[model samples]
Target: MPLLQRWRQAISKMSSASPSRFAVLVFTSIIFLWSLLLTLPISSADGTPTRYLDALFTAVSTICVTGLSTVDMSTHWSPFGNVVIFLGIEVGAIGVLTLASILGSVVTRKLGLRQRLIAASDGNALRLHRGAVSESQAVRLGEIGGMLATVALSLIIIETIIALFILPVFWASDLVTHWWDAVSYSFYYSASAFTNTGFAPNPGGVPEFADNGWFLGCLAAATFLGSLGFPVLFSLVRWARDRSKRPGVHVKLTLAATLVLFVLGALTLWLLESGNSDTFGSRTPIEGLLGGSFLSVMARSGGFSTIDIDAMNDSSLLVLDALMFVGGGSASTAGGIKVTTLAVLFLAAVAEARGSSDLQLFRRRIPHDVLRLAIAVALWGAMVVGVSSILVMSLSGAGMREAIFDTISAFATVGLSTGLTESTTPAAQLVLAVTMWLGRVGTVTMAAAVASSERKQLYRLPEERIIVG
Candidate 1:
C-alpha cells in the first residue's frame, strides 16, 4: 500500500478523537512524510542526501506555509525537490482538515462523521473556546461538496491567471534563462504569492522583480487576494453572481482592517525609510513608493521583499513587527492573530472607552463570544512570542531585538528575517521550528485540543466585578 494510505489507516484509528487532534496528527504526518522524501539524494542538486534535521525543518516550514528555511531553495534543491516543496505548499495552503475532506470526497464521494466534523470546524472557522458546533451546523453533504469545489476551483483559476500574466515578464527579464524555467518560475511564484507562502525559487527573489511593474503588480494582486481568506473570496464571488448576496461580518471587518493596515504600513515605511539610503532612499520616487507599498502588503504575512530587511530603521522594524503580528484574515493562508481579530479587539477597546454596551463595527453589533475569542487568541499569541523570544535569547545569545524579531517572524509564519536565521544554533532553530508549527496550526486549535473534556455548564455562576485596567 502507498505511504499515504498507511497514514490514512492510522488516522482512521483515531477517528473517535477530537477534530483538533486529528488535524494535528494529519499535519504531523505530512511533515514527517515530506521530510523523508526530501532526504533522498534525488531531492537535492548535488546528488547528496539532505540532512534529516534540515529536511525536517524545511518540510515543516513548507507544509506550514511558513517560508522560513534552513536551506537556500534555489541552489540546494533540484527541480524534483522544488516540485515536492510546491506540492507540500499546496496541501498546506488548502489546510489539514480541508485536505482530508478533499481526499475523502474523491475516494468515497461521501463523508463520514469525522470528516464532517473536521470540515465544519475548519470551514466556519469555529472557535473552540466557544465550543464546537451542533451536528446540524457541521457541513452537510451538499455544502461540503460545494465549499471544497469552490475553494479548489478558485485557487486553480487565480493561480492560472496570475501565472499567465507573469510568464511574459519572466520571459522578458534576466530571471529566467530558459522557456521551461520561465514557465516553472511563473507557476511556482504565482501559487506561492496567492498562498501567501512567499517562497520564490529565483535566487534574487522579489528584488529581481523590483522594477518590473507587471510582475510586481501581478504578485501584489495575487497576495492581496490570497490573504483575503477563502470565506471572503467565496462571499465576493457569490455577491458578484447575485446582487442580493451580502458579505459576512468577518469578511467586512477583514477587508476594512486589511485596507487600513496596508495603507498605514506603506505610509509609515515610506516616511521612515525613504531617507535611509540602505532602504528606499537610493531608489527612484516611483520605485520607492511602489516598494514601500509592496513592503506594506508583505508585512501582513507575505514575506517577499525588495529591500534589505536587516538594514531598516528601528521604527520601521517595530511597525513591521506589529503588522506581521496582526497578519491576514482568519482561515487564510497567512498567519498571526488575524486582521478581524485585531480589528475586533481594537473596536472592543474603543467601545469600552466610550462606555458603550455593545461593540458595534460597521453598524453591526459584534458578539461577546467573538470578542472573547479575539482576546484569547491575542493573549495566547503574545505569550507564545514572549516565551519563544526568551528561549532564543538564552539558547542562541541573540539580543532582545534579534530574538523578538526572529521569534515573531517564526510565530507569525512571516518568513522575513533579520540577519539572524542563518547563524542561529540548532537549539534556536528548533525553537523557531516549533514556533512555526504552532503559529500555523494556530493557538485556537491548540486550545481546543487541550481544553478539558468536562461537560458544559447548564447555567452560569453569579457575576462578580473585577478590577479595571
Candidate 2:
C-alpha cells in the first residue's frame, strides 16, 4: 500500500510538472497493462499464453492505433483479446489526456483549470510547454470541455453509424454465416475503421470484402473522417449548423491538404499499379480506382489494405512511403509528422520562392514560431524514420525498400507493410514498436517531455546570416 501510494504521488508530481511526460507515462502504462492482459491464456484463441514479445507488440500497435502486427491478428487472439484491443484503440484514438479529462469530468462533475490544460496539451503540444503559444491555431482553453464532449460523442455516433451501414453489407455477404458473428464483426470493423487502426477481426482480413465496395467505402469514409482530427470535426459541425461561419486557417489547411494528398496519392497509385498484374492489372477500371483510392486513404494512417503490398512496384512503394510519412492531421488518431506539418513546409518553400516575408495561409499570418515548430517536427520525425530504418535493415537483413517501408509504416503509425513485419527478427519488431509509440506520441510532445526545461533567453545574441546554396 505504501509503494502504491508512492507511485501515485510520483505520477501526480510528474503530471503537475510536465503534462507531456505524464501523457507519455499514461500511454506507456496503458501499453504495459494491455500487454500483460494479452499475455494471459484467455487472451489467446487456443487458451495458451501468447509470447510476451508478441503481446507487447500488439499492445503497442493497438494503443498507438498502428495496425502492424507480428502475429496473425485474426486467428491468434480470442474474443476477449479482441475486446481488449477494441477498448485499447478507443482509449488510444482519443488522446490519452483527453480520455483522462473525460473521466475526471465524470467523477468530479466539472472540468477544472488543470484538467482543461492537460486536455488542451493533448490537442496541441504547444500547451505542454511553459511559454505562450505563438498563434491561436489550437482550440481555446474554454473550448476544451466542448472538444472533450465532441471527442466522446463523435466517436460513439460515428462508429455506430458506420457499424449500422456495414451490418447490412455483412448480412448480404457469406463472410459470416452466423448473425451474432456478423453483428460483432460489424461493430469491430466500425471501431477499427473509425479509429484508423485497420485491424480486421475476420480471418481473411480486408480482402474478404474486396469485391464489396460498400463495405470498403464505409471503412474508407470512416478512416478519412477519423484522420480529420477533433478540432476540424468541431469546426465542421459548427459550420454545418451556421453556413455563414467558415472554418479557421488550421481547418482549411488540414482539409485542403488532406483532400489534395488523397487525390494525388490515388491517381499516383492508379497510374503506377494499373499495369502490375499482381495489383490492379486484372481489375476493372472502377475497381482499380477504388483499390487505389482505398490504399491511398489507408496510407493516411488507416492501415487497412485490400491487396497485397508486396506485389506493388518499387515506384508505388516509394509513393506510399511519402504518403505514410506525411500522414493525417494534428491531434488526430492518425499519426506521422501530420498533414499540417507537410502543408507548412510546402507553404514555406513556396513563400521563399515567391520572396515573401510572411507565412500566410487562408488570409492569415502564421507566426514564425509555427514554422519553426513544423520544421522541428519534420526533422525529428525524419531522424526517427532514418535511424529506425537503418536499425531494422541491419537487424532483419531486409532490403532497403522493405525495411524503409515497414519502418515508415511503423513510424507514421500507418500500419501498411510490404510483408516485412512478420518475417523480421524479434529485435527489429521491438524497434518498430518503439517507432509506433513515438509516432503516436507527437514529436513535439516527446521533445518537450524529454527536455529538462524550456529555456528562456534574457539577452539577445548578435546574429549573422550564413551562406547556403
Candidate 3:
C-alpha cells in the first residue's frame, strides 16, 4: 500500500477501535514517553543517569496519579525533572478519556458525535452500551462540551483557591524563608492534594507541617473536592446557581456516601489508634481527632498522610485497606472501585434484604445492568488487588500486612504506605506499578476494552433461577 493509504487505514482502524482500548493506549504511550524523559541525565539532581526501572516506576506512579515512589521524589529529581512530574500528574489528573476529549476538540476544532460519545462514556460508563442510565445519571450528548468546560474550569478555580489557602500557612511556618519557596510549596501542595497524588516537594513531606492544623485542613478540603468527581462538581455548580434545580441522583449518592465514609473512617481510626503511642495516642484527644480525620481523608484517595503508617495497629491498617479500596467518586481523579460502586452494592444488598426486585435509590430505579457493572467493577478490583498482593508478597518476602497494605494503596491509588514499597525488590515494584496503572485506568474501563468487540444478541435467553447463596 502507498504510505498515505497506509496511514489513512491505520487511523481508521484506531478510530474504529473501542474508546476504552484507545484510552489504555494513550495512557501507556504517556507513561512510556514520560519514562524516557525522566531517564535523562537532566532529570536527576546530581546529573547521573537514573535507573530505567526507577524512572519507569516514577513515570507510572506520576501518570497514574498514584503517590507511591521508589526514590526520594523531593531531592532525586532536578528542577526540570520536578516540572515533568508536576505536568505528568496534572495531565493524568484530568481522567484519561476526558483528556482525549479536550485534545479531540483541539485537533478537530469541534467535537464530532463519536468524540462526544467517548467523553460521555468517560463520565458515564452507561454510555458505552453496557446498560441504560436513569435520566438523572445520564449526561446528554449535547451537554458534553459544557461538561468538558466545567471540568477545566473547576480544576483551575479549585486549585487556585486551594493554593491561596496554603500560601499563608506556608509563610507562617518555618519551612520556608523566601517568598518564592512559599509560593512554590503552596502551589505544589495544591496540585498534589487536588490531583490526589501525595508527592511532597520537600524532604520530610507533609509531616513537616504535622502540627499545622490549618494546613492539613486545607489539604483535606482540596482532596475532598477532588474526590467528589467532575460530574458531581458540575451538578453542584448548577444547583448552586439555581436553588430550584436539585442535583442528580449520582451527585446525591456520591456526596452522601463520601460524607458517611469520611466520618465513619475518622471515628474508627481514632477509636482504634487513640491508645497507640506511635500514631495518635501520644497526642491530646483533640490532636488525635485531627490526625485521625486527616488520615481518613487521605484514605479516600487523597494520598497525603500526616500520621505514621508504620506505627498504626494492624487493625487500623485493615480499616485503611477497606477505605482505600472503596476510594472516591466516579469520573474523579481519585481511584479504586469508587464510592458509587460501593453505594450500588450496598443498595443492592438492602433491596435483597427487603425482597425487592428493583435496585431503587432516591426514587429512581437503577437498571439491573448497573448493578452488574458495579459488581463486576468490585470483583475485578478485588481480583487485581488479590493477585497483585500475592505477587508482591512472593517477590518481596514482605509480611502479609505490609504486602496487602501497599498493594491496596497502589490498586486504589491511595498512596499510603507501610514503608514497604521503597524497600521492595524491583520485581515487586514492577507489580505495584502495574497495579497503579490498572487502578488508574479503572476496572470497568479495562473490562470494556477487553470485550469491546462483543456483539449484541437478538434473542433472549430462557430464564432460570439459581439457588441463593
Candidate that would win on TM-score = 3
Question: lDDT, candidate 3, residue 33?
Answer: 98
Q: Estimate the lDDT of model 3.
A: 0.86
Which tens-of-lDDT digit does each residue in 1-469 have in candidate 1? 9987776666565644556766777788889999999999999999999998889989988998878888888789998999999998888888766765555444444576556556555645452334544333223334665556667887899999999999998888776778999999999998888888878898978887777778888988988888887767777776778777667676777889999999989888998998999999998877788888999988777788888898999899999899989888776788888888888888988998999989997667776766766777888899899999999999999998888887898888888889687678888999999999989886647434433243678999999999977
lDDT of 2 by residue, 1-469 (tens): 6885676566555666766666677778889999999999999999999999999999999999999999999899999999999999898899766765554444445677766877876666666666676445637778787888888898999999999999998788777899998898999999998888989888898998788888899999999999999988987887788886667888999999999999999999999999999999889888898899999999999999988999999999999999999999877889888899899899899999999999998778887766777888889899999999999999999999999999999998888888899889999999999999888875747544533256889998999999998
- Encode model 3's per-residue lDDT on 1-469: one tens digit a residue: 8886676455445644667776777778899999999999999999998999999999999988889999999899998899999999888888887766565555555687767877877777767674344455535677788788888887789889999988998888777889988998888889999989999998899989899888899999999999989888877877788887688788889999999999999999999998999889999999998888999999989888877798899999999999999999888889989999999999999999999999998888887777877888899999999999999999999999999999999999888899999999999999999999989886748545433434679999999999978
Output the better candidate (1/2) by TM-score. Answer: 2
Q: What C-alpha RMSD separates each model from the true structure? A: 3.2, 2.4, 2.1
Task: At residue 242, give the lDDT of candidate 1.
Answer: 78
Residue 15 shift from truth in candidate 2, angstroms = 1.4
How much lDDT does each candidate structure score? Answer: 0.80, 0.86, 0.86
For model 2, which pairs clash?
Answer: none
TM-score of each: 0.92, 0.94, 0.95
Stretches off by above 4 angstroms in model 1 are 1-13, 103-109, 112-114, 127-142, 447-455, 458-462
Give the clash count for model 2: 0
